[model samples]
Target: MTYDTFQPHPDLASLVKCYWTLEVPPAADSQRQRIVPDGCIEMIFTLGDDIKRYTSADEFIIQPRAMILGQTIEPFFIEPTGYVNAFAVRFYPYGFTSFVTASLHSLANKETPLELLFGDTPAAELEQKIIPATDAKERIQIVEEFLFTKLKSEITIDNIVKSTVGALLETNGVAPIKSILKDDPSKRRQLERKFLNQVGISPKQMGRVIRLQTALKMLLNRQSDSLTSIAYESEYYDQAHFNKDFREFTGINPKEFLGHENMELSSIFYAD
Candidate 1:
């Protein structure tokens, strides 16, 4: 397995978190890998064999070759059919809203093909440009140019939504939403409405996910000697509170996370 991430151009730095690529060799006994919510949206292009995203205990669907993976609140599983080569754009929680008109809430927890959001002609043209790219550098250039064109006609994110997201990120999701709004109830309500339209989840949900991401990195890196300490550092109420929220997003306990075969891919993602 080879996994890598690259910085986005300075013009897009605020919106795009990074561009990433993953390549994995064929395995005769590959297991379904679990992917958890990370409070961001992604535009993915599968450049190798088909991958299956399990929709239920026994049912699955082939992921779109070019698709937008919207904000996912729950964990899901995916397995590669053979060799895995994928390129993706990781957008910050509020970044993707600048490129599309669809309500983020409507896209939550599922993969929507690019054509559905960008229309057939534009989406197809972008995919064609991406498919034959010789390397990650070329792919990033293609996608960045595509995003730049989209930005010309799209509306920027609301100030309230952008600032609130910034606050959540700055504090590692521990800052209270009400406090961020200066305790204005009216602003809270307005933020909630715009958050759903722009961020795909409630402010509280995004906060929790961000907090978990902090703790998750610590755990993966062995930054702390115990879960209790990790929880404290992450500002969870307690170890129990941390475990509950951890299970809520990851579908597993912390102790099991690092050792689970199904978490191999997710581990690489968070560890990076």
Candidate 2:
């Protein structure tokens, strides 16, 4: 397995975290990888064979060649086919809305194919042009050009929603919605509605996921032997609180996660 990451265009930096590429050889024996939410949307393009997303035993679905993965509230599993090669653009919590017109709230927590968002003709044409690019650099350029030209006209944030998200992130998911909305309770409710539409999870839920995400990295990296220390560092109230959240998100405790087959490949990327 080989992976690389790149910076996004300056104007898009706030919304897009980075562009990333991953290539796996044919014999890599792909394992199921879980992608957890991090307060962002994403756009992915496969350069080789297809990828599969599994929901349960005996259920398999092929993802679109090019798709937008909306903010996730929970983990989703993916397995790549032989010689898997792909490039993905990861959006910041606020970045994807700039390029889209249909309420940003409408795409939350789901993977919508590009053709569904853009009209078939336009999306089809863009896919043809991008898929032909022989290298990752050229492919990145194609995506950047499309986004820049499409989003040229308008870039504005819904103030109330932005503030709510800001508060949630700033507090490391420990901040209560009431505390965040003390300035305006009405705005808090509005934020929840908008989050449901655009991000697929309420501000509170996203906050918890973000906190767990922090601890997940620390555990995989062997940063500390004591779960209590990691819990404290990640802002959990106690070891038990950390364990509960971990089980909810990953269906396993911290100890089991390290040696789990399903988590093997993903563990490497988060390791120190």
Residue 207 lDDT, candidate 2, scale 0-100: 86
Whole-model lDDT values for every prediction:
0.94, 0.77
Query: Per-residue lDDT for 94-124 in model 1, tens only?
Result: 8999999899999999999999999999999
Decoy 2 TM-score against native = 0.90
**Which stretch of 10 consecutive residues in model 2 shows the poorest summed lDDT?**
263-272
lDDT of 2 by residue, 164-239 (tens): 6777677666777787777677787778877765555677787887788778888887889888899999988888
**Candidate 2: deviation at residue 148, Å?**
1.3
